[model samples]
Target: EDQVTQSPEALRLQEGESSSLNCSYTVSGLRGLFWYRQDPGKGPEFLFTLYSAGEEKEKERLKATLTKKESFLHITAPKPEDSATYLCAVQATTNAGKSTFGDGTTLTVKP
Candidate 1:
């Protein structure tokens, strides 16, 4: 079965605290890895897409990288507004258009 799991369901970090979020996954074969950020009442916003191991994408203080078995979202010096749920999803050849999403890692940044 293809599945994705995120660690530390919730995280509380003081402003400027840097941390890395983990997304572990299991799939028949990975076609793409997606990273998204969601706020309190909005749908997820695309952040990055990783198609292969060793590939990475970055924007502002956020960085996403993917591997054969897992992916990571790293937050550096985060701010209050940066607080949100970080979601990881994966699409396999057999699961095309059906991206399985992790429960999500909720991050709270305290200013």
Candidate 2:
């Protein structure tokens, strides 16, 4: 079975503080790993897609990295506007359209 776990259920950071969120997973065969940011009641917004180990993607102040068994979301000098729930999900080679998702890490960046 494919599984995903995100650490630090919640994180508190001051504006300009940089941090990284962890996403660990296990799958029969990795197809892709995804990162998303979700606001209070809105659906998650796509951030990155990693296809293989050592793959990485960046957008604005966020960077996503993938390894064989895990992924990381690095936030650089975040602002209050960066506060949101970050979700990690993975698709397995055996599962074409289904993905296993982690509960998510809620980040609150305060000024």
The deviation in Å at residue 17 for candidate 2 is: 0.6
lDDT value for candidate 1? 0.92
User: lDDT for every model?
Assistant: 0.92, 0.96
Model 1: per-residue Cα lDDT at residue 102: 96
Give the worst 10-residue stretch by lDDT in candidate 1: 63-72
Question: Taking the tens digit of each residue's C-alpha lDDT, what string does model 2 give over 1-111?
Answer: 899999989999999999999999999999999999999989999999999999989999999999999999999999999999999999999988998999999999999
**What is the C-alpha lDDT profile of model 1 across 65-99, one tens digit per residue?**
88888898999999999999999999998969899
Error of 1 at 99 (Å): 0.6
Q: What's the lDDT for candidate 2?
A: 0.96
Please identify model 1 stretches exceeding 4 Å from their true place. none
